[model samples]
Target: MDTKSLIIEKATILFQQKGYKSVGLTEILKACNVTKGALYHHFPNGKEQLLIACLQVLNEVIMTDIESIFRRHLSTKEALLSIIDKLIRDLETEGTITGYTFSSIVSEMATVSEPVRHACSALYENIQQIYSAKLVTDGLSNESASAIALLMTASIEGAMMLCLTQQSSDPLKTIAKLLPKLLKDI
Candidate 1:
């Protein structure tokens, strides 16, 4: 991979394990085996720039995956259920949902860093839009579809957080079961 991509790959792991503020340039440099000068050459603004790059990379990967899921021939509800199942499987493999999410980092840095906050916010909005479009295509009214998409997204995020903190998949399964019934109303 190129230096910039390498930096982002390594930083994603570090930031996921150790919040943005806790992981410094030295740690990221050491992990990537890149010198301070090399890091600066690729990211002139230092750690902040690197963090933003990591967020962008993550956002693209996740949004693309979600979009592809929707684009599949599966029904909208099936696609949504598949997303939850995939997330559960990923968490089981990763041991922590944090690795698959930048939400924790956004929560930590949002108040202090406007750029990071905006990057995270934009990612979330994209996700909601994707789901809203799918729901509308599935026959729900635009307003109801949008609202349901937002609600379901928020619930999934919350369920993931709970499962991660509790170190149990039961919460995930519980939420999965609840999701279908919840969608019945929409």
Candidate 2:
């Protein structure tokens, strides 16, 4: 990868593991094996700028993957099931989950950092929009579909956290069963 991409890539992993506020520019520079001057050359504003870029990079990757899953021409329920299955498989393979979820990170930083808060909000809104679109395609009224989509997203995030905290995949399995039941109401 190019230097800029390398910096972003390294920053993404660090931010995911340590969160935005906890990580420092020196650490990121050392992790990337780049000089402070090189980091400044790419991210003049330093850590915050790099954090925003990291958020943007992660948001794009996640949104693209979600969109691709939703675009598989399945019913919304099936599409959602596919996503959950993918998540389970991924978690199993990775052994541990890393990454700052938009909601969790926002809640952690919102009181102190407006810019990061807004970035997290924007990422969530983008995800919600994608979910809403999928819900609409599944035949619910726009308002109801959007509401349900938001709830599902919130629930899934919660489940993921619980699963991660317990070092058990049971939460994922529970959601896999519950999600289909919830969708029947839609």
Give lDDT tens digits, candidate 2, residues 32-141.
89999999999999887887788888789888888999898477788888877887777788855554344445656767778887887788888888888878887889
**125 in model 1: Cα distance from truth in Å?**
0.3
Which one is best on lDDT?
A: 1
Task: List the candidates' TM-scores in order.
Answer: 0.94, 0.92
TM-score of 1: 0.94
Worst 10 residues of 1 by lDDT: 94-103
Least accurate 10 contiguous residues by lDDT in model 2: 96-105
Residue runs of model 2 more than 4 Å from their true location after superposition: 99-104
lDDT of each: 0.84, 0.79
Candidate 2 pairs with clashing backbones:
none
